[model samples]
Target: MNTLYPVMLEPQEPSGYCVQFVDIPGAITEGETLEECLFNAAEALTGVIESYIELGQEIPRPSENIKEAYYIAPDARVQSALLIRWARGDRSLADIARALETSWPSAQRLENPHHSPTLKQLERAASVLGKKLVLSLE
Candidate 1:
């Protein structure tokens, strides 16, 4: 799934730009320049995603058909966590653990935003989840 969230940028009074994710309410930020605004938007998006994970809430998928919207992605760690959770779908953590031949905690850590799972570990998890781990430079 594409992880880039579409955001609307509104010019603030006298200076800067305010950014809000189209599909994620409460994830907003502003900065003094377009570059800074984009940077802060990424941070804001990551924070909101982490909060969603902590609250056991489903993270909203990125909208594909938004017009005149700029796209931004969360930090790599958050993106990895979200991808793992989305790939797991209705499958239990135990199910993933069994497929990976690992303990439940280890498999659970793969989806932890705070815990950095190795690339090999992520690749293995993706394989088990019927996904291919593909990385690209933006």
Candidate 2:
């Protein structure tokens, strides 16, 4: 599934725009222009997700009903980390480690947003999780 979150871009006083994420509470940001606002929104979204991971909280899934709403995606590393964690579901990291024939720490690193896992590592993890790793540009 494409991991694009919907955001509401509201015009602010005097000129700029304020962006609020539809699914994530408190994940809000503002910019002096539409371009800058959307850019800031991406950073805000990534930060929120990173915070969630650090707190061991479940990351909110992107809403699909995006009619008339602007959408944004977090950076690739955050996206990859979230995707792996979400796909792992109830399975243990140790299970994935065993299937990948790697140590637990290595498999665990796949879910660390700060650690950039190689494409091969991500693909193998997805395969073991019975999911496919899909990448996109935009």
Candidate 3:
């Protein structure tokens, strides 16, 4: 099953943006663009879920009051940051591909937000990134 949660997008000082989970405290992410910020927020949420699961903890569900302060299209900065973190963390695209049982190029496509990754693929990518996928209604 797929879970979609409500996330709040807030603009930050200087440049870039940040995301906040309505139900999860300290669960935040930022990026140079709205797309990147949102995507990173998703990934960050996944990671938080994974950590909870690993520790046999409970996951936080989204609240009914979820709302977005702003709206923007996808951006490349999010993909780049995700890729950079994956690389810096010594996480290989090939490894993620293998974990998701996909081809390297396919995995590469996922790293590119512009490629339009499916929810399942994103879930797998999150798993490979040591995260869990969750979606909740707003």
> What Cα-based lDDT does every candidate model obtain?
0.93, 0.91, 0.59
Candidate 1 C-alpha RMSD relative to the actual structure: 0.8
Better of 2 and 3 by lDDT: 2
The residue ranges of model 1 lying beyond 4 angstroms of the native Cα positions read none
lDDT (tens digit, per residue) of candidate 1 on 27-101: 999999888988999999999999999899988899987898889999998999999999999999999999999
**Candidate 1: clashing pairs of residues:** none
What C-alpha lDDT, on a 0 to 100 scale, does residue 53 get in candidate 3?
38
Per-candidate TM equals 0.97, 0.96, 0.47
Model 1 per-residue lDDT at 36: 92
The best candidate by TM-score is: 1
TM-score of 2: 0.96
**Model 2 whole-model lDDT (C-alpha atoms):** 0.91
Candidate 3 residue-wise lDDT at 45 = 68
Flag the better candidate by TM-score, 1 or 3.
1
